[model samples]
Target: MLVALALLGVVCLALGGFSVRLLLEQRRQAALIAQQATQGAALELRLKELGKRLESYQRINVRMGEELGELRKQVANLPERLARLEQRDPASLSFSQAARLAGMGASAADLTQACGLSQAEADLVARLHRGRPQD
Candidate 1:
């Protein structure tokens, strides 16, 4: 009976030692799980902030695209607007140059060649500026 009691004591000690080691390992694992959860929560928050920033950037890009579209429309109309302005001023650069040449006694043909004036415009310049008639 005393021998049996001694063997039982040895087994009990072995089990106690194993249980202590297991408890310590479980505690370590619990601490690691807690740290990882904290990191995950922080990463989630950062991801949400980045998503908000992305949304703001998208809004800004949308506004810029709208403005660019308006600018494109204005640019497309620029040529027609410029044509109307030039039509309003018949005495443009060529006409002025033709008139100066006519005042300097240049013939209608000379005004046409030197100033790129149309034949009718050259004749008008000659008549208005008292230039000599074509021979």
Candidate 2:
């Protein structure tokens, strides 16, 4: 009977040790799982932030493309207007008439002052005024 009790006590001690070891292992595994979950949440937040920034950049790109198209249309119309203005005759008028037809304003004095022209130069401009004359 004494030997049997001693054997039973040894078996109980072995089981208690095994249970403690298993409990520690379970706790370690749980801690590792929690850490992984935290990391995953952080990664998800970062991904969302990146997605928002990408959307903003895409919107800006689209707006810029629209503006560029408008600029291209305006550029395309320029040559036609220039061609019409270029076809007018310059030498057929008196100096004052020539200046008026050339889109120089009604005030010849003001035009001369603004252009820093001598009287002779102003008279020459009136005499040989051309449409869209070069600076």
Candidate 3:
């Protein structure tokens, strides 16, 4: 009876040790799980920030594309606009030049020679601008 009782006490001690080991392992696993949860939250926040940055970059890319397209359209129209300017009336150009020369206090003969204006047109411009102060 004494041996049996001693054996029973030894078995109880072993079981108590095993239970303590199991409890320690459980605590360790819980700590690891908590750490993983924290890491996951941080990763999710970072992902959201990256997503916002990507969206901003995409918007900027779209705006730049639109601006580039507008510039291309303007560039394409340049030749036609230049053609119109080249085709403007010779008389109109002469008249404009005559008016500018007359405004500078040029004589009628000077207007006629320099701006290809008719004598009558040169006289008219000279008369019209005679009152303005000279630069």
Candidate 4:
């Protein structure tokens, strides 16, 4: 009977040790799971922040595209305006007509303003007129 009691005590002690070990392992597993949950929450927050920034950039790009389109339209009209202005003849009016329109008696400044000619162009026109022999 003494031997049987000693064997029973040893079995009980082994079971107690195993139970303590299992409890410690369960606590360790719970700590690991909590850490993983925190890490997942942080990753989710970062992803949300990245998504917001991407949306803001997309809006800015759209606004810039609209501005660029308007600029292109304005640029397209420039060539037509330039072409029309180039078609005008600056020397169509005779010196007498230019003098009359300028309200001066054939003066160089008056002719320049009347015919929309620069000073150099008016001087050239005057020289050409003088070179012509009077009929």
Question: Which candidate comes out best when scored by TM-score?
Answer: 1
Candidate 3 residues 25-111, lDDT tens each?
Answer: 999999999999999999999999999999999999999999999989866765464345335776554655665677788999998
Off by over 4 Å in 1: 83-91, 94-135
* Candidate 1 per-residue C-alpha lDDT over 2-114 given as tens digits, one digit per residue, 9 for 90 to 100: 99999999999999999999999999999999999999999999999999999999999999999999989966765464345336566654665565678779888998888
Q: Residue-wise lDDT of candidate 2 within 104-127, one digit each (tens)?
A: 433445445655445654544543
- Candidate 2, after superposition: displacement of residue 2 in Å? 3.8
lDDT of 1: 0.78
On a 0 to 1 TM-score scale, where does candidate 1 land against the true structure? 0.62
Q: Lowest summed-lDDT stretch of 10 residues in model 3? A: 78-87
Candidate numbers sorted by TM-score from highest down: 1, 3, 4, 2
Model 2: lDDT of residue 91: 44
Write candidate 4's Cα lDDT for 2-90 as tens digits: 99999999999999999999999999999999999999999999999999999999999999999999989976765464344335563
Candidate 2 CA-lDDT value:
0.65
**True-vs-predicted CA distance for residue 81, candidate 2, Å:** 5.0
Model 1 residue 32 lDDT score: 100
Point out where model 3 deviates above 4 Å. 79-135
Instruction: For each candidate, give its TM-score against the true structure.
Output: 0.62, 0.55, 0.58, 0.57
Model 4: worst 10 consecutive residues (lDDT sum): 96-105
Deviation of model 3 at 75, angstroms? 1.0
For model 1, what is the error of residue 14's alpha carbon versus the real structure, in angstroms, after optimal superposition? 1.1
* Segments in model 4 whose C-alpha atoms lie over 4 Å from true places: 89-135
Which residue runs does candidate 2 get wrong by more than 4 Å?
79-135
